[model samples]
Target: MVVAEVPKLASAAEYFFKMGVEGKRFRPTVILLMASALNVNISKPAPEGVVDMFSTELRTRLQSIAEITEMIHVASLLHDDVLDDADTRRGIGSLNLVMGNKISVLAGDFLLSRACITLASLKNTEVVSLIATAVEHLVTGETMQMSSSAEQRRSMDYYLQKTYYKTASLISNSCKSIALLTGQTAEVAMLAYEYGKNLGLAFQLIDDVLDFTGTSSSLGKGSLSDIRHGIVTAPILYAMEEFPELQSVVDRGLDNPHNVDLALEYLGKSHGIQRTRELAAKHASLASAAIDSFPENNDEDVQRSRRALIELTHRVINRTK
Candidate 1:
């Protein structure tokens, strides 16, 4: 297999480094850093006896998987910006915006190559196969979304399934990778994977709610991309189901920017946004329940990660535009 070019970390890396660098968010940055560090190896102590009990071999496997997964994820974002023609992300200019789309797409491709190379190095054919499948699902999700137009936003089945592939599958894969590294039972891996899948659904629901509610200032992208792109996310899809009439506005042929605002209003009238949040919360609850399968000792960090993950999940819902 061809190797991917590693991203040049020179000047461009500085911008990513600056995130949460100042003021009150400094602590948030530290927490993010700590989590990143933990991905490689648990530092600082694992809360009482947790450290002594963790299998070092399993931890190493988890670290390698995480690093590979993260590189793939970051690369995908770069490519996604180009496809979406998105200018902003993570509250700043997108990679395409900064480096130009041609270079950005190359960078994304490079990251994917890097991830695959890392996957191959693991020497575990099962994991390499799983990662490859996950990447294919991601591409499928992107294609499905592209086919949507105001004329046809797709059905609830399509929407949820697309959401699973686009947003949740990678996370679920990450959990499964964890189990594989730990030499856990297949039942354990499947349970963790299912938990991740549910968590991802909740995560996407919150994202859909955010598009309407979050500020352009906070969210980076223009809040109405979902409607404009003809992609009906959970909130709007729920609206379409509840008030069938709203479908007309969503399906309005090649809706220009002029009508996007009006379409949003119609969706709002159906109370789809609120309903979406309720659904996301239900999924989050399921993810939390999945923690029962984890060993009692090492669970606190993972559980705290779950709680923080839940908080971020809710933030996606309440975000105001």
Candidate 2:
């Protein structure tokens, strides 16, 4: 369904959409799992004249929602690669690198328009509102990073807030949407949102750690690229806590090759990587607790789903790429 939405233009847009189709598809997978778990009691009969919980219609709608989530995520990646001037994504040449910025940006816009169309077709106002808010958060987060003041860039609180907007908002809201579609209570939906939010934070924290520790080949992109781009990620932020001298280097825009080397040296010597791992672990724990806190029900399927979600939290913290 997602691939069909992309026009068969004899241009780079088709390539961009094909590349998107080959992604890990992590966002949609999570949505499907959450939907399955939330609606575990499918054996229960619906009220007369109503669709059954496990009916073909319900499953089709859920699949459409999953596709919508993936479309939005891929659209974001397309725009991000252009903004960051990223050369590679998911181990392949970026659309901007292959097609130039104008086409890439327009392709991204095209994908977004398709996603919005799908969202409207769902005809669920609450789900539409949640996803619209996620889009707003994504833009706000990117703007915050691009336009951050010097003092604001150094603040941990500011960094985490930006992280939430950039990484967590989509997953959190999508999880809530899944719960809402199941007609779950407000409290249960919030719990689903909380779980996704913490998991996303942990995922991004690990990604930052990998930036410093993983190889370019392993990461599928240039290592130390964030600092090279004049962006200070979590490791750099924590390293500055121990080596205050690095601030001057950061303030200098890290334009000098020598300063970049010195910054990397400081980060390696400091506890930055370890501390970042600790913080990620903390969020992972919170995510697990969120799943565990879901009200205990006699449905065995629900119990299994909760356990799977908890295990996913661990995987988020421990992923290498």
Candidate 3:
């Protein structure tokens, strides 16, 4: 659905979408699972020839929601590559590197426009409002990260809020949308949102950890890229607690060749990596507990879906790449 919307005049857009075909599709998968789990008759047999119009309509809406979610994600990635001047993405050259910045940014806008069209087609004002807010949060989060003062970069609370805006907003809102489409109560939808919110936080925190600990090949990007880009992530935030002198280096913008290496050395020696992992684990636990709090049900499908969500939290923290 995402690729088909790319204009033929802009072939580069198709290439960009193709590159993302093999992505985990994590956001959409979560939406579909949540839809099934929340369905009241998920475990019951359908009435003969009745067509289960409610189930059919729900499936169609959920699928569109998934496509819209992926489109938004890919659009963000395109814009990010331009902002970061990234050369590679997903182990291949980034679109901006090959097609230039103008095309990449325009393609991102094109994808976003298509996503909005899909969102409108869903015909649910509340869902449209939710996703539109996610897009706004994405821009605000990226702008905040880019424009943050040196002192703000060092603060953990600022970092976490930025993380929520950038990473959690899309998934959390989409999870709520799924619940809403399924006609779930407001309380249940909030639970789904909470689960997605914590999961996204944990996911981004672990990605920050891997930036320090994982190899470039494993991570599919340059190792230590965050600090090199002058972005202070979770690991660096924790390391500042141990080595106060590093603040000056960060304040200097990490432009000096030696500064990055020196900062990495300090981070390696400090308990920053351990502390970051602990923080990620704390969020993962919150994510698990969110799903666990769902009302008890004898249905095996519901239990299995709940367990998958819990396991996904574990994967978010433990993934090597």
lDDT of 2 at 241: 99
Off by over 4 Å in 3: 3-10, 40-48
- Estimate candidate 3's alpha-carbon lDDT, on a 0 to 1 scale: 0.85
My TM-score estimates for the predictions, one after another, are 0.80, 0.91, 0.94
> In terms of TM-score, which candidate is stronger, 2 or 3?
3
lDDT of 2 at 270: 94
lDDT to native, each model: 0.65, 0.82, 0.85
lDDT of 2 by residue, 1-321 (tens): 434443542355456556553367777777877876785433344678886645656666677777777777777887999999888986789888888888888877777777899889888999999999999999999999899988887889999999999999999999999888888899989988998899899999999999888898878889887788777889999999999988888887776778899999999899999999999999999988877777776677777777778888888888887
Candidate 1 per-residue lDDT over residues 123-218, each given as its tens digit:
888778777877888999999888755444647778888888898887777767666665666886686677667777887888788877877766
Error in Å for residue 247 of model 2: 1.8
In candidate 1, the residue pairs with backbone N, CA or C atoms under 3 Å apart (3 or more residues apart, or in different chains) clash, namely 150-251, 213-319, 213-320, 213-321, 214-319, 214-320, 214-321, 215-320, 215-321
